[model samples]
Target chain A: MRSRSAWTIFWRTVLGRAYPRIIGAQREKSWVFFEIFLPLLQVTAYVYIYRAIEAPPEFIGFVVLGGAMSAYWLNVLWSMASQLYWEKETGNLELYIVAPTSRMAILLGMALGGMFATTLRAIAVITIGMLLFHVSMTVRNVPVLLGVFLTTLVALYGLGMLLSSLFLLFGREAWHLSNLLQEPVSLVSGFYFPVRALGQVVAAAASILPITLGLDAMRQLLFPAMLGDLRFLPAEVELGILAGLAVLFLILARRALAYFETLARREGRLSIRGQ
Target chain B: MRANGSRSEALRSLRVAAWLGWQIESNWADPFVFAIYSLVKPLAGALILVFMYAVIAKGGLQSPLFPGVFVGNALFIYVPAVLAGISWTIIDDREHYGMLKYVYTAPVNVLTYLVGRGVAKTMVATIAVVMMLLLGTLALGVPIRFGGIDWPLVLGSAMLAFFGILLGGVTLVTARHNYGVGEAVAGGLYLLCGVVFPLDTLPSWLSSIGRAIPITYWVEAMRRALLGERTALFSGLSNGALVAILAGSTVVLAVLAVLVFRLAERRARAKGLLDMQMMY
Candidate 1:
């Protein structure tokens, strides 16, 4: 057999890893109901809560946008962060380790696949929510919105890659940790409101999570008239922060995956199940 | 003699299953981490509502409506936790742990075992509920009166467990690969049951659907018991009438749960699905 270059192998591994998530997503019909419709229902509930409170119409837009971005955060937590632990439990981690490819490539593939799948759900949420609630937005800057949005995904998935390694190291605690992160992250991230409403200090701390800045930035751009004063920072600064986060997380994730691979080899934890 | 022997066996299974459920849930982390784990999610969940109210309501947490909404959201945790606990047991044992076939072959009653598992989740959720109530009263001034609590209505509301078992029975026959069934139902009920908002907030057609669901009444009853105020939608009914309706609804749910479980058990056995693993 002809030898493949490291670059060739890495690219191929990424493609192979992502294939299942991208294609298999379409194969499963239940995901639409579970992922899209159910989340839409939750968004609807929040919308009703805002209505019940007699909040401004823009608040409904906030809930709709928050509900949309939440799909990505969930994908990061469950499908990306806890994935390697799941793979370990299901006895697939050993195969990936034994294979002669970069572990980061496998993770990148998972990230790409998860991003694609979750985007479909997120878009569905935003579209349906807009139609149902008549949420109006003023997207003044398309390029900036896309830039911040993409950077946010990069940083968020990078964080997921890092957590995947940490989660595998921690074993069963990862499941509880993942659960712990969900609602708390949503709260701190100001998923259904402006992060500014959480006050400056708390919002500053929550910026560690990429979605916090991402959601804040997107909302600022989309709902300038209502959310202009409520933004935690100027959208420009948030974009810069997101870019820095993207780079920092990718570097950290690379190092963590290397350390994890060494530890797993020495400890022989890859084959351990039900931990 | 046979009936007595079977009853004792079922009781034993239930007792053991509850212990096992608690162990599986809490033993993954040390006591400290587990305590933090239990505290954070529910508190954060409550905080989400608090922040939402703060942003919109002029009076912030002091809004007259805050207490009921806070209490309602706090109690709503049980719907998802218990429902997921019971239904996910089927998925966990069958799919994740691959022990469902062995469990089925044993002398255990699956329905009783599921109820036992749900008991552990109820305990966890009760802690969250109590913590939320304390935080509401002390920190947020939610106006809960310990003396005014209707103990009978509160106790009667425990019949909500039957709904979890009913959903679990549906899961036993239907779910092969999906894990979100419990959460999906819970999310829908969160909207329908007026967990955070009143039923009147929903459109009349949707509110009618909410009225039909046992959980809407369950939330309203809990609010009445804990907050000493009846939901305007149900204000027409007196406390006794509310309790009677809850009891009647619970009886219907319990009977339906048993029948559903029996039918699901027969179907699962016929389809050879008890041991089936999708490996997704």
Candidate 2:
């Protein structure tokens, strides 16, 4: 009975926290428009570049898929990982740390809220790309695509939660750490082109990033015509690897919480604002 | 300490502000991290464009158009560094440090003070610019012919471009102080300025907006002046015409930004909104 009540309390805390954030995101109408439109403009630039050099017609869809997937990664870095930094600045981290609830509950709230908000922008980008650029997508299996995408998000968010602890421990001057993630991740993940387009050594190095595997699997499943030229593993193998990574990162995040708390307590770094 | 401020005294204050700006930016990180941090972003950006060129052309950096991508992305480093140093630095001062009121109340004119701050930012950005140029030539093997250089034209075009960025930064920072969202404007400029692709391919309505932005002409003119190659995306105009257009735009925009900033300062102070703007 006690365990049941604890589980119930945990979920209630998460949903209660996430509700206002999701609502607040909608309240800022201009930010919502900017979020959707800015990414589409970025994708449009790549599409036009491809047009100039006469890349394969299907590369348009590839670029669109890559752009949409990358929005989730951005959310992870900004809304999930850097969230602890903002909370520290805003004085909420202190209250949460003193509270009785599990730390993962707070991150769970962030992940759900961020994913909810980012999905809207991602969907808008996809729809706009289809209408404006006429990107060709041929889904072979709906269930498989859904599975791969969800698994990828799970792994990505787990990594984000792990990063949160690191950021929390580092405090304010470490914003460069998050900035370090963006462009390198985009480049390594092959956001506009396939990883194999890079040489073998680089491709092997890039495969370490789960998003690269995720994107390749997604493109292969959604556009089966590209399957003949698949650079990474098959969809099932990629999805399985992503699932494994999800578990691995979640375990690491749990360990990171303890490690970060000890470090923060020793260094007296908790809730140090604007360092 | 006279009631009437002398021109020399104001200039001294401006010089101090510029020095302080440079010091604060440099001290943000340790020297080692700062150097590595500076190189990573621009190099990664160049790699992205290089990868795209290779994929589309079916030959790695062997494409006829690779030189354009190489130089374009290298020069694109100045956009974010300069724009952020101007607008976001002000936003940070007012919002994070709560220093804007004191800055405004200082004896130095705000326009002169901002121009001084801009000079400091440009100095830091030039380091990154030179690094990018070296990375492109030495590491990436981008074909920049030394013999074809137009030294005077390049210098003239560069000055106007920097001036245009300064005016845009002033306008953006003024808006930021009043209502917030300076970062979004900076990000929007990165996309709209014809940095990587040509503005001509955009829809006519969007291209019209591009036509008004001075950075469009600046990037085009810089490419033509430095490389002696016409832009494949936009701006077929002669270098002289491009420089003339950018200079005129800078004068008009600088005057407009000054007026707007003055009005915004008055209104913000009147309504007691200086501190309140940070809540966003």
Candidate 3:
């Protein structure tokens, strides 16, 4: 009974540490301000979306939906992309080298912090879209949308972690690798315009990422009539592909993380951090 | 108060000045290292922009954004590309490698030394701009006729370059002592500066706000020079007028850099940041 109780107590403590870390992480100011600033830019976006729509009601619907949908998109690849870069620069990243905590946990914690922060921006944007732009977004298939959101975040968060791993092992002192990831992703993701409009080649390249398919699938439910004529490899294929990409990116992220950890051990400069 | 004592003090200060000057020259050698490190990110950013444009054009957006427009926009995109990619270097060197102390102690006045460093970086950026221009014209098959070098755009870009270097230099001086967000300092400027696509891509009002920025005029001037448009050649909004503005800004920014450094040094002295983080 004593041994069993000790084992039980250990697992409980493990679970207990996470919530406080998560809470403390989100309460920080970076989360609050960046989220607010991102959605505030949507005032201009509403103007563009309204011009694209045919009817007044459709405009309201599209603007509201676009406001909510855009929350899922942003330029955090810079924020997250520079994880190793910032660490290497500030010397704070050195703590991770010595800490007994899992590197994966540390990375996931940071990403979750960023995602939640960006999601808050998404919320703020939707609030403005509803109040100012007079958007009347409907709730249909909430579960499906949530699933797509989870998977998209998972895939992106995974890719971000993988990039961090690369930077840890291979970054020049400057960590330009983050720029390599952030800028290209922003352009190709079709955040501003429809990816399908990007034609077959970009569309093909984008389909490999979960966000493209998630956006497509989510849009199908939200604006089915607007995009009804457009074919994007069918709903089932898009979701399956997104799921596949998420898994593939996660596997790659895990492998990269492990390789980096091993390399850190071998190099004996894990604590040195940065170039 | 005595004349002999004053002379001895002056000699001691001169000795300090020479030592500081020597330090400044040796420390600035990192510019050569930085200029090389700067190219990788912009090269990647350029390739992505070109590839995305090709794919988007091929997709038949069915808009007026022909391949030529892509080439046109691509050149202006480098303004931000250069700024964003390299913005971190100056600040990063100070915070990461502890190079700021050498800068402060160097014999040359900090402002004059920074002007030279800024020129070196601008020269590097100029080389990158040249490479990007040649690649776009030759490979993309776009006609960017020189049409007697638009001196205005050149001046405007020089001004934009000044803004980038000064803001970066100022940030370096302060951040060495006071911690501020480097990415925010760098990336925010890139977005706010109207470098990538025309902020006109957004709305009329936002575009107006974008147009109000010095970079807007600079990039517009660049577009005119490279695209061979003589229509706005001598308009009141001429690049010459903009170049004048740029020259004024260059002087102001240079003064501001000195001010920031002097302030930073005093603050660092109070906080002991001046003697902090010495590196070989």
Q: Which ranges of candidate 1 are over 4 A from the true structure?
A: A1-4
> In model 3, which residue pairs have backbone atoms overlapping below 3 Å?
A199-B59, B20-B105, B20-B106, B20-B107, B21-B106, B21-B107
Candidate 2, RMSD to the unseen true structure: 3.1
Q: Model-by-model lDDT, in order? A: 0.87, 0.72, 0.53
Give the candidate order by descending TM-score. 1, 2, 3
Task: Report the C-alpha lDDT of model 1 over B119-234, residue by residue, as the tens digit.
Answer: 88888888888898999999998988877888777765656678778777777777655678888888899999888988899999998999899888778888888889987778
Candidate 3 chain B weakest ten by summed lDDT: B60-69
Highest-DockQ candidate: 1
Per-residue lDDT value at B208 in model 2 = 83
Window of ten residues with lowest summed lDDT in model 3 chain A: A46-55
Q: Candidate 1, overall lDDT?
A: 0.87
lDDT of 1 at B80: 90
Ranking by lDDT: 1, 2, 3
Candidate 2 lDDT, B147-245, residue by residue in tens? 676554454334433443444444433434332233455455556666666666567787788778777776666677556788755545777777678
Worst 10 residues of 1 chain B by lDDT: B152-161
Using all chains and alpha carbons, the TM-scores for the candidates as numbered come to 0.98, 0.91, 0.70
Give the Å error, residue A214, model 2. Answer: 1.1
Fnat measured on candidate 1 = 0.78
